[model samples]
Target: MTNIWEPIRIGRMNLPHRFAMAPLTRSRAQADGTPGELAAEYYGQRASLGLLISEGTQPSADGQGYPNTPGIYTDDHVRGWQRVTSAVHARGGHLFIQLMHAGRMGHPDNTAHGRAPVAPSAIAPGEKMFTLGGLKDAPVPRPLATEEVPATIADYRHAAARSIEAGADGVEIHGANGYLIQQFFSPNANTRTDSYGGSIENRARFGLEVVAAVVDEVGADRTGIRLSPGSRLGGIAEGEGHEAFYLHLVKELARFDLAYLHVAHGGNEELLRRIRELWPKALLVNRVNRPLEAATADVEAGLADVAPVGRWALSNPDFIERFRRGAALNPPDPQTFYGSGAAGYTDYPHLEASAASA
Candidate 1:
């Protein structure tokens, strides 16, 4: 039977195990959107996770939603990530940089741009966002002009090219978690009458355009996309008739023949089953908040090609080793989870250290 311990083939990359590290925002980047100095060390420490997916990296300045989140749009950003990719490669692990564009879930005070966020429509997420000034209500975003939507899609291509230049094994477009792509998918967040909104096909256009652009810049084998169906995050409402739209979106995305399809599961088992049937390639499933013992339940059931974990892998750098040894995992500290320093970032005890202390 397939399990997390087994090997898996994702796109052009052949991972030794089915253990993938899900993207977790560490918010430790420099003010200029470059990765922190310790970024390499932190990712390298967890290279044992097989596939290390980096945090939400903005494809453009306007794409940033939070302070100190890394960007992959600039040459400096490429250089900053090179160290991280090299570190992971040296440890025999592959790194996929996640390209995220936060739509209406931003405070101008949070991003260096100081401009209102952009989305398919000028709607607000109705959530308080952390910013440079402090916590503030998310502001209504500026609607992307019909003509400007293509340029926004191009931004993803540019970032994907830059990610490849940085020696990253691949790039995962952040289409999930109520980000730009998902914003376009949500009826509440995107109520535009343009060709980029309204109908499911039109709403799925922006996401497909961005994905196609990335696949064109970088090979399909080097591209992946994360999606969260029926996710109410960022005050998004997929609408009561949402299941059909999600299935249609997945069917359309499969035509690209891109890399894996990573789903941030939102308790829709039937929908996930449908998605698994529709997708022909790798399918990564993150059972949100599921315990360690059930991490690979989807994999064992042949529903997921990989089992991606967040907190478990975060607190235990030697995640696979500890699992093999049945060693107790160090509890993750909520305080340092999103900090600038290396307190809980890189200070998590490895299996050997824990064994020594014991």
Candidate 2:
């Protein structure tokens, strides 16, 4: 039986364990889209995990969806992330910078330049977004012109290159959770009649193009993507053909021989099984809010090559150690999950510290 603690090879990096950290947005970056000073220490503390996927990082200025979210498009952003990469590497951990382009999810108040969020169509998600002012309704996004699609693809490719230059192991294109790529996949959000919308294949085109561009910039071995097949987040309603669309998308993605396909499981076991079959390489599954035992079972049952945990890993810096010894875990505090400080971010106690206090 494959143990969750066992080592595995993901791309060129050899992971010391099969438990990867899922990307969780903590909204802790500087106002200028640069990572905070303690970002390195925060990430390095969890370096024992097989993989440390960074929070959703924007590829361009307009990609900023939430306040203080980091970006990879600037020199300051590169330098800020260099510190994080060095710290993680010092502790023998591989890092993948998740490239998240929040299309219609952006509120102008949250952006640096107050640019209108762009998507496949001029549709608003009808969702509220966190901004500097306060929680506000998402504005109807300005639809990208046919000529502007290539520039968006270029942004992804540029960010992938920048991540590598900053010493990242790879980049995971964020196509999940009703972000830009997912916005294209969603029929309700994307009602365009262009080459990038309408039918299933057309909807899948933007994602495939982004992946292909990233693969070209970085090697296929260093490229991965996260997808939520049947997700209804951000007011998205795929209605019918959700499974068929994802199946087709996965089949197309497999052609590139990418590093891994990370799926945020949306309670569709049969659809997940089909994706696993279609994808012949590494597969990482994230079962949100599930216990450690369930994550271990996914790996042992061969349902996933690795199980990525979010909140558990966030609150437990020594998550691997705690799980190995069956020790107690520190409960995650929801109040401080997103903020600007060391209070809830890096203040979580490890096993030794907790034991000493006891």
Model 2 C-alpha lDDT per residue in residues 1-358, reported as the tens digit of each score: 8987788898998988889999999999999989998899999999998699999999999788998899998999999999999999999898999999999999988876988999989989998988878889999999999899999999999999999999999999999999999999999999989999999999999999999999999999999999998788987888778998998999899999999999999888999888888999999999877866676888898889999989999999989999889999999999998875998899999999999999
lDDT by residue for model 1 (47-162), tens: 98988899999999999998899999998999999999999999999999999999888888877768999998988888989876778899889999998988899999999999
Candidate 1, residue 245: CA error in Å?
0.5
**Candidate 1: worst-modelled 10 consecutive residues by lDDT:** 104-113
Q: Report RMSD (Å) for each prediction in the order shown.
A: 0.8, 0.8
Runs of candidate 1 exceeding 4 Å displacement:
none
TM-score of each: 0.99, 0.99
Shift in Å, residue 79, candidate 2 = 0.5
